[model samples]
Target chain A: MVDVSQASGAEGPAISMRSRLSPYALPIFLIALIAVSGIVSPAFLSTSNISNMLLQVAPLGIVVIGQAFVIILRGLDLSVSSVMATAAVIATGFSGQNSDVLSILLIAVGIGIATGLVNGWLVTKRSVSPFLATLATMIVLQGFRFAYTQGAPSGNVPPLFRLIGSATWHGVPYNMMLLVVLAIVFGVVLAKSRFGREVYITGGSPTTARLLGINADRVTIIGYVISGALAAIAGLVLSGYVGIVDNWVGRGFELDSIVAAVMGGISLSGGQGGILGGLFGAAILVVVFNAVLLFGLPVQLQIIIKGMVIVLAAAFYVRRRI
Target chain B: MTALAPIRLSSRLRANQGVLVVAALLVILLIFGAFISDRFRTTSNILNIFEQSTGLALVSLGQTLAILTGGIDLSVGSMISLLSTLTSGLIAGKVSMVLPVAIGILLLGLLIGICNGLLIIWLRVHPLIVTLGMSAVLQGIVLLYSLGPAGSVPPSFNFLAYGKVLGLPIGAVFILVLFLLVALFLRYARLGRYIYAVGDDEVGARLMGLPRARVMLTVYGFSGFCCGLTAIYLTSRFSVGQPYTGLNYTLASITPVVVGGTLLSGGKGGVFGTLLGVYLVSLINNVLNFMDVSTHYQLIAQGLIVIAAVSIYVEKKKRV
Candidate 1:
């Protein structure tokens, strides 16, 4: 069984003194993967291949940031994948061949916010468990996307939006930049903000939080809403990357995000984890997929490997928690 | 006496079957069916509903057991897919129909259920995460084995599916048998009581030294076994093993389990309630089809029904 690493206090100077070495384990795994791949292909370390890895991981990284928040609140949101799909569809629809770009962008953001709010309300007000509620939402939204687009996906992302996925400004891709920005925002929120502390309290022990006058339900709802919003943004970047919108956009994304979050050392039972840890987890996942491709493993085998990693990560997380 | 009566009423409410909500929904759909088309009232259409509901009901029983232990088995769908493919593929391979099919399904189920249990218990992980991963792994394995759908059911199996027994479809008989077995186990078995105790509170059960690990393993194992059984029957009914089959089983299974009044948190509900829930869901779907509502509206309606059922569960619990 895995052991929980050293802990940082709930606040203040105690946090910085705690070693940031938790991410070291994940990075070592990545290096090992890279090393193994290099031995096989000799071209695994090429600049282009490395960039490809980052690009592939960026969409999932963004979504994992949201997943971290929800899990930290001791809740899970299964709707992020569908929220991503809905957002991508809406964004693509508005980004018609001829349109004012700004208005379309606004609509996309608005739709994302609205989706998050609905998910938040259902879980908070209706008292539905996050699991079942989000699942229903996910299916319903998927149905909507499928119905709207029929079998074929229509519309392309605008050139501007696509740039974020494709362009490299000063040799750094826009998606990578977005990831960095999200990381900083999430770091500040989780480490410095009052709301973040409240989230932890809620997840650590809901009954205690309620006793302490904390609105645990509200915090939980907020956590999911944040996750939903982040997933929407991730969808925007994803659609940009692909240059097209499809009904199946972000299919099984929730699974990926959960895997990333768990592997990154974010506990599934919630209350203790960092956003950067999740990003590293996402990186490790993408690298594994890349290595599999490099080795020419069949897609089915690749799925099996991915599934194995997910189970391993979760198993480790649970052991560490206990 | 009045206060005592209210207390008894509350207990009954707490222990009450979730079938009524499902039944009420079915009646509503029936009226809608009558209003939309006269064909809905036809005997064959009703029979078709029963036949189709059979496969889902069988799988839902497995789902009910897993959920009863305060966990889920997403792999049930994938297990069904794997077993269906195996059963048909074995028959297609000119293997003995009964033995190969039985062994194949059982092996797949045992392997998957054990993995889930080991991951959750030995690995100390959440059931959802382990099962989710297992689902993917199982799906991949099925894909690897089948390569592409290539299997056919033997005539004997289909006889059980399409043939009549006591004027009831064989599929319906299978469902009834499953219900009876589950009801009996929950009522009489020591391990079954342990399952209820564990679901009510894991820590408390452990403190009581109730063989928590064994209970967990057995419940999950039982779920896997039932899933395998359901897969065989489903393949028989469809007459073709589909590699990409059971795509919808995850939701289809859960809808009945949840609507059956089993608490998602575990430690409540039973097989009989699941039977009613299964029929109610299938009946609603049938009635919707009869009304000729666009297929698009069907999912939305299903989603609404689950939400409504959970909402009622929550409200009832909140009141007590």
Candidate 2:
């Protein structure tokens, strides 16, 4: 519907430039940001600092993998942050010695999957928009958390959680290693699997996908399920890193995951970007957040910067697509 | 062709079903509320419900316009938070500054909306992202400006919310007048119809040579203005501005719009239905408060209503 004022002859360079730089843009930008930060605060890139950053980023990266799948399927999951928080709270609530780690893990993932199922069912079967469905779920979950916690949450992040989340091997945090392994596995799942291609097709063109016998609804639901499961895992990782359970835990990671996925080249409108890009986006965010903390800036700056990142990334990725 | 009249009648019933449902539910709630609680059916209590609903009603009107045009404004809550803070901070309890501060904050709200619209157009990004980002920016600004209850309004300024006109709260009166005006505009005005047309079918509206950019700008700008108005009322009610004052309005505003029968997909909803939705939600909350029974199951009742309402409409659309 837009009027193209320029002639075809004049529009060639911009198109070529986008193709050449878009994929590598986040990494290049990450490096540039690192170099600036390293110069400004030489301690920012120190070995210990890097490991700390990795530990902090693992939770976000884990969630980003899930978020990328949902975005790739042309859906948004607002309930992810809620899921993350709920999982953490429930995991920590079992303060008794009788509770095993495996049971807690199962319960956390079960919460995520159940939420994903509800979200998926709403979007796919009941015909609710993904945004609204997830938003409603988020609200319900928030209310649930409030009712359960009554504004004051009790319980500690288990020692096992803290150990898995913060412990390192040869200066590499365990959570970071988990994130890397999960990313590779899911990345391969997304790029090479039949389900992965189906997700892309459904997002890119539901009609075409339907014609090709892809169960679009089933695929979309699975995407939500994956998002839910990963977000739950992310929640535990976050609680471990923080070493506590509180109402505020995992509150804003939904936006961060969206920003990360979108920044990493996962298209907001769907059917684009990849797992590696999401990881890179998470890297960029962690570095930015680390730098902000390093500067002793107010946390409010992080909120403002996050908004700017979403807008800028949307501009970079979405503007050219049309 | 021969059966057109009956089909048209049925379709019209179906079309207006959301408002009818919400209206019926509102009536049912009033009845249930009155039956259960001694204080429920009094005129003052009922009027109080309407007064309390003014913020939601005002904000939802703007949300209705946005959703009606196949978009959303997630920044309304944050804008309210920012504007309310700016209002009290700028006025600083000076009665003389209230006029200027009010005008400035209202304009700022409109400016925020226009910025959201412009960014959407410029970046060719979805409204969700633009407004979500704007929401964060506004939230951050408000936090930086004030972490807690920041400033106070003069006693005289409280009239916006607390003043009574013919036994009705002034704020509710404003809602009546504004809702009626917006409803009329939607029914008769060109831009109003264009809003529906745009939301109903963007491609068709573009092909019809409608000013798509201008339409989006006006829709968002009005939404922002409504938020500004709501913030003012909120500030008047509370007598002080706090950073978190408007945070809940973002979701609260959307609920009324959808519950009143507006489609999230845009194009088929109205201000009156949204108004009814607002009243219904307020009454539900009031009744819940009266009962004092917390439904862990009940906690989700609101979200469930939104989901259920949206599902009904969306399912109907799919079948058609």
Candidate 3:
């Protein structure tokens, strides 16, 4: 996407260098973290450990991709966690031993689309603030899950899910491969598609985008629907990984995705950054967690470090922008 | 003259619509509650509702201030958890340690507030993300301090929650007094006006040469202080320092603020509306309890209520 002429035309080499450097920063940081972890404990560099970490972070990476889209539209889906839980609950609760897994997946996707439509209608039609609207949806969905499951979810995730969730091929995790393929597809769509350009324009300025004849409202709704569907996919994967369903499933995924997206340099203000940034951000967070584990620190310390990283990255970005 | 009078009256009514809506809702709910259950109107039950609302009232007050300045403080809940644990740990059932513990907690609150304000002002980050990060940090700190509930509160502290003053619950009285003080400050203080101005239009307020950073800092600091006060009350009521006591306070506090008719985008609404909002929520919970409805329904109801309230309020504002 970088054109040498455009880089040299207006902003000069300094701005171009910064722009070029920013996208690669997360991957470099991930490598550095991996090196540090390997130095701390050589076992961290083992193939098994690396594969395991990839499997664990794959779901988060998927969710982060979805979050990146919504955030690019200058909106947020605080309901993602609840949406994930609802999807998992629906998938398992409806699917019996003889039930078809494909139909269950379809049902999950339907629920995601319905929830996204509700969120979109509230934001686009009713003019509600995205934060409050999504939060309200989150709370309502949580209650719905509780009422539906009656405090405990039943039925087991299908074996197909298990295969996808935990199986590997030639030393690479299937889930990780799924994440990589999805990431590439989304990255291409964001970089080379008209819809992606419209998203950037709409987020940059709704009025301007509308003036340019872009269907801002339609775009926003579609963005939310995509986010919902992706979140449900993540939920499906997570349910398979855990092998059971509960109301608390995907409890913190929303915040985790947001953190990863922000750390990847996706502007919260929207209209900038890409899915690749989100993937890199998710990878960095996973590596950090792996490093923390290798260090044998308490889980609480991991939380503390994660919080510090968010604040520090935000501060750094703010300073750089200024 | 007659034409001007109607116009003025309509404008005044529009200005007070939030309080009016919440007050009307409260009255209707109260009447419905009384009709549904004989115990709903009992003196003890009414007092209990008021007492239970005190913590939320304090937290909402802080939230209102932050929101008025076009910001939010998600960390208030976590601050409550941390302050409660820290104060209760220090108290350990000793009345002599209350003063020092309380001061320490308040100072810590102020320090957190300062950090939040400086980061937002200097680094210029979105308040939502900043506060979210702060909440996570505070959660970690609380976890580090105590894995679970710990420490016993002094009896003197208990009086703040359970004591009676002039035949009314002390907690209710405290909330009323605090409400009046905040109302007066918002009505009369220069800083309060500046807050509204900044929230209404940051560029305009800056052009007017208002001390934007200081106003933001004071707003956050005041919010932190409210959290500290809430921590004390919660600790007393529970009789122990619970690490997760304030887990729901963040959302709960926001509910009242939004339901009270305060614009989420800021620059409108008042603490008076918040008072009515708090009572409205408390009454709803009380009624649900009386009707034997599960708490799960209440959660759903709260969510619907927030969405409905914000939608109606924003639509009204737009029309005006």
Query: What is candidate 1's lDDT per residue for A153-201, written digit by digit as tens?
Result: 7777878768887777776788999989998998899867878777777
Q: Name the weakest run of 10 consecutive residues (lDDT summed) in model 1 chain A.
A: A1-10
lDDT of 3 by residue, A95-206 (tens): 5553568887898888888888888888888888777788888899888888888888888888877777787899787888888998888887776788887887787667
Alpha-carbon deviation at B303 in model 2, angstroms: 1.3
Reference-based lDDT, residue A173, model 1: 86
Identify the leading candidate in terms of DockQ.
2
Per residue, candidate 1 scores C-alpha lDDT tens digits across B237-298 of: 78777776788788889988878888878787877778888888888888777667666778
lDDT tens per residue, model 3, B1-320: 98799899999999888788888888899899889989888999999999999999999998998888778888888889988988788898888888888888888888888888887887788777788888888888899899988778767788888999899999899899999999899889999889898877777888899999998898888888899889988988888887788988988999898888777777888888888889999989999899998878889998998888877876432210
TM-score of 3: 0.95
Go through the candidates in order and give each one's C-alpha lDDT.
0.78, 0.86, 0.83
* Models ranked on TM-score: 3, 2, 1
Question: Pairs clashing in candidate 2?
Answer: B295-B298
Error of 1 at B219 (Å): 1.5
